[model samples]
Target chain A: MEGFLNQLPIGLSIGAVLLLIALGLTFTFGQMGVINMAHGEFIMAGAYTAFLLQDWAGRSAVLVALPVAFVVAGLMGLLLERSVVRFFYGRPLDTLLLTWGVSLVLQQLARDLFGAPNVQVLSPEWLQGAVGPLPYNRLFIMVLAVGSVVAIWAYMNRSAQGRRMQAVMQNRQLAATSGINTGRVDQRTFFIGSGLAGIAGVGLTLIGPVGPTLGTYYIVDAFLVVVAGGLGQLRGAVIAAVALGLLNSYAEFWTNASLAKVIVFAVIIAFLQFRPQGLFVLRSRALT
Target chain B: MLSVDGLEAGYGRARVLFGVSLAVTEGQLVCVMGRNGVGKTTLLNTIMGVLPATGGTVTFEGRDVTRLKPHERVKLGMGYVPQGHETFPQLSVLGNLLVTLEASGNPQSALDDALEVFPRLKPLLKRRAGFLSGGQQQQLAIARALVTKPKLLILDEPTEGIQPSIILEIEEAIERLHASGIAVLLVEQYLDLALRLADRYVILDAGQVVHAGTAADLQGEEARRLLAV
Candidate 1:
């Protein structure tokens, strides 16, 4: 029990970053029906930005870099969607190849800019330490991750623009007929989704050293959370991430971290084999 | 209130509507009827600006709106309800109503006029549209158009998949909408309900108008021969 509790914070912090990464991926994957293999690169770009900014302006610059990362990543996503992604909205396999190429290009760009060596970033003084009732318990990074989940969920469900996006996600043609500007919705959704990923990258820099391939480490786990939750479901991402966090944490108590992934992957693969749609699908006609 | 003349449109290289022409007078109920693949829905889509007219002049309220966008047409007093009961599944019934109203330059608070057409939707406003039955969704869809308070209300296949009782309710709503001095352009297979409510009828076949006359003339053998009903 002590070992399990000891491992909880570590697993949860990683899962927190995973949740943010997956949230953005789910928007394009689940709603628009695209598998952007290069999405991890957006995270990498944001992490690199955070690293550079932390060095230039001090650790307190995270607050400023966080939003800047969102803009930079979102603009990259916006341009990508308007130019390349517009053609690949319905073509999943093509999207896979295109985004994969994009990811490679982004990683190379980061390597050239930040150098081959991994860069380190520190969280601000207040945001550096542990949170919650127990000392050395929950990580501050995990708290920001948890807060990001809440913020994203609220943005998706509460805001008028979010409703418009959800409306488009639910029924694109119907939304168009109802006078929703579907093109604008698509562009904005891509920006928001990618921007969240950028924020995830900045979050990653908080936990460890930032590098060009930092995004690659978390991409596989992000996909698992997104798929398990059923794509585009904001709440599903958080729930799945938290549950997977606990599962991985407990497993890592006895099993090695690498074996823990095998266990999680096997379970997720088995899950999808049974429920092809996902654990919490919104598109199913269960209501009507 | 709407005039479409010499309209030619199609899916791609193949032409479906061969210079079709039609008119809906002020405050009159006009129904367009045709067999499957007869360009009934296509004409509506072109009229609503969802489908661009390949060659045609669409003038609404004396404005040449052939080039206007779909949302722009809605602003010029044109409301469209597609053949299927299409509504945003994620949005609540109220949200659907508000979205339509917002587009039409109104809001949910100004829905007294729409409520008169579909009082049933008032109670179920909070429910997600995905949860509604086919009939309820249809009612909500029509109400969405009504909230626009358009000069011309265009509904394609408004009665399909609806129960008999609900069809009757829709018929009553249409009659009321017409009586309130709003123009109605309807497409339907329920010939009896259509003929009873609509003042004029146009039968189309293979993308051309086969017959056009008052609905009162539906009694003759020509009606059956032309409609294939």
Candidate 2:
């Protein structure tokens, strides 16, 4: 019973991490339909931002690195969108290959810059304690995830810019005719999406090692959450993340981690077979 | 206020508009009439800058805007409501109107004005646009464009597939809009409606203008012959 109770927070924290990583994909992959295989690298960029900031901010580097990493990763995403992704719009296979190649180059660049070995990110003294089974670090992650979700909700629902983004996502031609600069909106969406990955990377430095290939560890899980959640459906992603998190926690507890992964993949595949559109589908009148 | 000189456009080697040229004076309501598959929609798209023009120039308010983007042309006082009663389906009726009003930097009163023009949308403001009936969606689409405070409004088949009652309402709205002195370029299949609202008419056939004349000419046998089947 105690073991089961302990896994609840663990599962929730895992879900929070999943939510953070997949949030960006909800925009880039879900809305734009651009298979950005290089998204993992943007998360890597965020992690590295924390690592580099450690020299300057010491134990509180992770705190300062959140917004900084967002800009860094956002700029990288914008550069990618402007230089390559824009041309390959509507050609999923081409973008997949192109972004995969970009991801490889980025991974290699990270290996060269930061060395092959993993680096440590020291937690703040304030985050040293625990509340029952939930460590303060894990609790911080959950709070961050909630905060991000709320911020994104406000941005998407309340702000003018966010409304324009939704307009473009729903109907590109109508949005253009309505006086919205769709290209500029696309650029902003990419920036924000990649920035969320950076924020996720900052949150991740709390629980794991910061390394060149760290993003590879969570990329598949992130994609799974987004796919199961549904495209451009925020509530769906939140629900899917939590459910998968709980499932993963209990599965790993019962068996080994490798078996747990296999079980999760099997479950997702089965779930997709039943509901291919996902937990929630966006309704739109736009053709293609 | 708008003029197209020798405009040409195509979709991947399948040319649609071949040297189509026409002009609209300020506040003039011109209707383009044609049979099915005559590239009426293609001409509006090219003029709106949604599709790249293969050749020729488009001038608006004495400036060449041939290479401008769709949004740029819109910002320069052109409004377009594409065919099929399009709206942001996931958004509320109010959200649909706000999307355009916000983008064009129009004040809140503009939205009120649009709602006033289509009073049928007032009761349905909070509802999701996708859930609305086809007629309601069409009204919402036109209301959305009107919120932008456009100098010219371009409509493609606004009355297509709509019920007679809603079509009558739309016709009244168009007449009202024309009375307000906003230049209109309308593509309509219905000859009676076209003649009723238009100050001038242009007939297109196989991607080219077969006839162009005053509204009186639209009543003649030649215009009817070109538009038939």
Candidate 3:
């Protein structure tokens, strides 16, 4: 492969990871008009579930762990909605404060259970194998990321339930008046959101070890993408993810990875300053 | 048929609609007119179950619907085109229509009927509803409400933001719906337009019905003064 073309899959792979994570957060924060600071906790919850399962069973357990994480995170989201997030919805500052507090509590609880150190999971042998022509490259991770995007894209765009979800996301009032049970929609969307996070955590486990403090680090970065993508926009998640992924990769190629993230965060802030509505403003009527 | 009696509703503690009562027969066009802040919109919203009524009885086709959820009311043959025609802007005009069809038990909604009523929607079906002009959106909004083939159609200011000619088209569409035996309950600011099409008119002031009579009674000078801004 040509030099630039050879790097395309890597860029696309990073984009997929960003896309998956961003997609999950979009529903919790974007469509439902939530400021879920604990979204990363859901991701961590997924990772932890996978980690625990990996220790008990063989490597193929990671696949089973994916669904288990989805259920765990989704149940947590439902509980959060019923308990905490519902009260402060539409009050962004209060929600931010609440979720920030929740992140700490969740992290401390995880530390108590799993210890403060990182816990690793072995990738399955099937997923462990690579298909790219290069001996030095491990590109199966790239395929997994792209595959997730395609699956999510199909679910969100083609199915009746998916279309209804889009309806609720686009305009809650109109959708409700159209005889869609928006409360039901809200619950389902939140589940999908949290489940997506769980899946993303599984993806993260494929690349890196998960720690009790896992959620704390990625929460801010995901928030950056949500703000940059024009909150509530699914496509905006894709755009912002790709842009941030490419920018971060290229910046890291030149500068340090930590410095590149700072630049990306700074760029997101600047983007917000210019387009407060986000990159692609989804004309939404969130049930605030 | 539709009926609302002693419908008292509010936003928070501030009561908006006070003892508002009205009825609409099937196939009749009923218009609710009032000055701004008279709770005209609230009355419509209260009946549609968007805003819960503090005290009232709302019966649609002889069934009590006051306690039903907005979407439940919708499933029971109620279609609302709220003020500003709040359609999903991100979706296309086609999407706007398709979304409403979920309310109907019919496998496929009568799309041809909707397109026939609003020809402009045919070309604009592929276009995002928000990108269309205000008039076009208005037409699409009404057509969207009709897609479900509701027994009762409620429109809250269908003429607002629309041009005079398009307003006429909407009025004509209401007339056609009325002719088809669908009850139409409309709240409009334009007195002339309301009087022209309505079989009966109910005027609100401070959430109470200040006047209720035939459209012909509105032609007299006293009712004319009530509509004057």
Candidate 4:
């Protein structure tokens, strides 16, 4: 019972991190239906931004890095959308290949810049302590994850621009006829999606090393979360992230880590076979 | 308020409209009537810039708007309600109206004005539009467009697949819109409704406007003869 209780916080922490990473993937992959393999790199870029900032400014670097990484990653996403992803809308295979190539290019760029070495991000004294059984850093990430989800949910539900995105997601032709600049919506979606991933990168550094390939490992897991969640549904992403994160944590506690991943994939595949549309079914008249 | 001269447009290689020209004056209700697949919707789409014009020009309020995007045209006071009354199904009725209001840069006031115009929508503001009956959805769609306070409203087949009682309601709403002096370019298949509302008429046959005349000229045999595929 004590062992189980001890593992619970770590499971919850893992779930929170998964939620943060998958939030951005939900927008890019689930809502827009774009295959952004390079999303993981955005997370890496955020982490590297934090690393660089910490090297430049010691104690306050972590605080400053959060916003800076968001902008950096968001701008990168916007650039990718304009230069490449925009041209490949509705062509999933092309987007997949293009973003995969982008991932490789970003990986190479990071390796060249940072010399393939994993950098340590020294957490501030404020974040060094623990809350009961939970590490303060882990608790901080969990809070951020919840905060981000709330912020995104409120924006999507209340804001006019967010409603326009919902309209575009439902029907592009109808949205255009209704006077929404669909292109601008697409741009903003990319920025927000990538920006969230950048923030997730900050969370990632709390638990582990910040390295060039940090995003690559999480990218596949994030994709799994999106697929296991219902496409175009935010609630599904949250549910799926927590469920999968806990399941993976429990499985890894009992078995080998590699086998745990294989088990997770198996469970997701089996789950999908039963419920193809996923946990939440989006309601929209398919565009003609 | 709107003029299309020698407009040509198509979907990829399959040409759908050829040299279709018409005029809609201020506060006038101009109906484009045709049988199924005769490019009535295509003409509207071209005018709204959903489909690119392959040839000719579209003038809206004396400016050549042929090359403007669909959203830009809407910003310029041209409102379009496409075929099928494509409401955002997931959103509530109010959400649908708010979309256009937000896009038009007028939110709260536009909502109040739209609700005042279509008071039936006020009670159902919180209801998801997909669950609404076809009539209600159509009303929401039109109300969504009207929230923008567009100078010119273009509707394609507004009465399609709707119940007769609701159809009558839509017709009455059209009358009110006309009375308000908003220029309306309506594409409708219902002969009685078109004749009842339109001051001027254009008949399209196989992607071309075959006849253009006053509504009185299209009263009886000429209407059936031109409309018959």
Candidate 5:
């Protein structure tokens, strides 16, 4: 019982991390249908931002890095969209291959710039202590996750720019006819998606080592969360991420770490075989 | 206010429109009539800049707009309602209208203006557009376009697949819009409805404008014969 109780916060923190990484995928993959393999790199970029800011801001670098990393990663996403992804719209296979190539190039660039070894980011003094089973850093991640979700929900539901983004996502042609610049909306969508990845990277720094290939470790898992949750469905992602996080925690406790991943994959595959559309399906009448 | 000179467009390598030409004078209602697969929708899309014109020029308000994007064309005072009563199904009826109004920099009063024209949409404003009946969705679609306060409204078969009562309502709305002096470019398969609304008419066949004249000329046998599949 004590072990089970201990795993609860751990599972929730894991879920929070998964949600942060997959949140952006819900937009780029779900709405735009672009398989951005380099999303992991954006997370790496965010972690690096936090690492770099440590020199200037010291202990509070993590907090300052959040917004800065968002802009840095957002600009990178915007550049990628304008330079490559725009030409590959509606061609999913091409985008997948193109982004995969871009991801490899980014990994090499990181290796050259930061060297091939992993670097550590020091947690703030405020986040160094623990309360019972939950550490302050882990609790911070949960709070950050909830805060990000709320911010995103408000942006999507309340703001005018978000409405245009949703409009463009639902039906591009109709949105264009409605006097929305679809191309500009696409740029904004990519920027936000990549920005979210950056924020996730900052959150990850509290729990683990920051490295160039750090994105690779979480990228597949992030994809799993988004795909299992459903495309463009925010609620679905939250539920899936939490569910998978708990499942991983329990499974690893029962068996081992590698077996936990296998268990999760098996469950997702089986679940998908039954509900192929995932947890929720977007109802739309737009003809491709 | 809008003129197309030798407009050509196609899907990939398969050309659908070939040297199609038509003109709409200020506040004039022009009906484009044709049989199935005659490029009527393609013409409207090309003119709206949803589809690129392969070879030709489109001038709107005396400005060459052939190279402009679809949204740019819309911002230049052109509104389009594509076939199939398209709406953001996930959005509420109010959301459908607000998206356009906000994009076009129109005030909230524009929503009231559109709702005034289609009063049925007032109560349904909070409902999801997808959940509305086909007729209701069509009204919402038109109301969505009207929120833009367009100078030229291009409709591609607005009455298609709708019930008789809603059809009458749409017809009345189009009539009111025309009476209000908004130039309309309507594509309709129903000859009677076309004749009722059109000030001038053009018939397309196999990607070309085979016949063009006043609505009176459409009363002759040649227009019907050309339109008959």
Candidate 6:
């Protein structure tokens, strides 16, 4: 029981990070059907943004990097969407290959600017100690993750812009007929989705090192979370994130980390065979 | 209010509309009729700017809009309700209406005018649009377009796949719209609805305008001859 309680925070923090990353993937891959393999690079961009801010602001760098990372990553996403991704809208394979190439180029750029080795980011003085059983850094991450989910939920459900995004997500042609600037919507969606990934990258520095390959580390798991959760279903992404986090934490506790991952992937493969459309498949006349 | 002169459009190499020219004067309800796969939808799509015209000019209110994007045409008060009742299934009926309002740059205004026409949608505003019956969805689609305050409303098969009872409701709505002097371009499969609502008729056979006349003049034999599969 004591051990289980100890693992809870770690599991929850993992879930939070996964949720943060997966929410963006949910929009990019789930909603738009764009196979964005370069999503991790956006996350890396966020982490490096933090790294640069830490160099300048020292202890307050993480705080400053939050918004800046979003902009930096969002602009990168905007450029990617405009220059490359927009042309490959209906072609998933080409998008996959092109984005993969983009990711490689981004990775090389990062190595050139920063270095191949992982760099450490220092936690603020306030984050040094634990509050009860929870470390302040992990708690901060959990709060950021929860806040992201709430903010996204409200934006998607309450805002007029969100309604337009939903319309485009369901049926682009119908939305266009209704006078929606679907191209503009797609641009904004990609920006916001990439911005969220940047924020996720900001959260990532709390637990790990920042490096050229930082994005590559989480990219596969993020995709797994999105696939396990259903495409375009935010609720499904949340549920899948939590489930995967818990499963990984518990499995890792019992066995080796690599083996635990193998188990998680195996379980996901099995799960998909039964519920092919993921956990919360949206039913719509357009989809049919 | 709208005129197409020598308009040409198609899906890539296979041209679907060949020199299809017609006009909808102010306050006129023009019904376009044809059998399945006879370019009925392609024509509507081309007019709405959802599908680009490959050749010729579409003048709306005397301004050429042959090359305008779909949203731009919509901003110019050209409203469209597509073939399938394409409501945002996950959205509440109110949300669907709000989207139109957002596009038109006045999202906060009450949908009094729209709701007045489709009063049945007032109570069902909070319900997901996909959950509504096909008839209700059709009403919502029209209501959604109405919120944009369009000068010319284009409908593609408003009564398709709907039951007879609700068909009357839709027919009544169209009549009311006509009574209000809104220019309507209707693409319909039902001969009775078209005959009841249209002042003028244009029949297309294999993407060409084969017959054109007033509703009274274009009768049984002519319609069968033009609309035959």
TM-score for each candidate, following the candidate numbering: 0.90, 0.97, 0.89, 0.96, 0.98, 0.96
List model 6 lDDT by residue over A62-116, tens digit each.
Answer: 8899899989999999999999999998888899999999999999999999989
Ten residues in sequence with the least summed lDDT for candidate 3 chain B:
B102-111
Q: Which candidate tops TM-score?
A: 5
Pairs with backbone N, CA or C atoms under 3 Å apart (clashes), candidate 5: none
Cα lDDT of model 5 by residue, B34-58, tens digit: 9999999999999998889999999
CAPRI grade, predicted model 5: medium
TM-score of chain B of each: 0.97, 0.99, 0.96, 0.97, 0.99, 0.96
The TM-score between candidate 4 and the true structure equals 0.96
RMSD, one per candidate, in order: 2.8, 1.6, 3.5, 1.9, 1.4, 1.6
Chain B TM-score of candidate 1 stands at 0.97
lDDT of 3 by residue, B90-140 (tens): 777887777677545545637668789898789888888777777888888
**DockQ comparison, 1 vs 2, better candidate:** 2
> Every model's DockQ, to 2 decimals?
0.44, 0.71, 0.43, 0.64, 0.72, 0.69
Q: In candidate 5, what are the lDDT values of residues A16-96, reduced to their tens digit?
A: 988988889888887789999999999999999999999999989999999999999999999999999999999988998
Residue-level lDDT tens digits of model 1 in A258-284: 898788888888988998767687763
TM-score of chain B of 5: 0.99
Worst ten in a row by lDDT for model 3 chain A? A133-142
Window of ten residues with lowest summed lDDT in model 6 chain A = A279-288
Summarize candidate 4's per-residue lDDT along B1-229 as a digit string, tens digits: 8999999999999999989989999999999998989898889999999999999999999999999999999999998988887789889998999888988897588778777767888899999888887778888889888887899999998999999988998898888988999999999998889989999999999899988889998886877998876
In model 3, where do residues sit more than 4 Å from their true spots?
A1-15, A55-57, A126-138, A246-261, A283-288
Write down the lDDT that model 3 would get.
0.80
Residue A85 accuracy (lDDT) in model 4: 92
CAPRI-wise, candidate 1 is acceptable
State chain A's TM-score for model 1: 0.91
- lDDT by residue (A137-198, candidate 2, tens digit) is 98998998999999999999999899998888888888999999889989999999999889
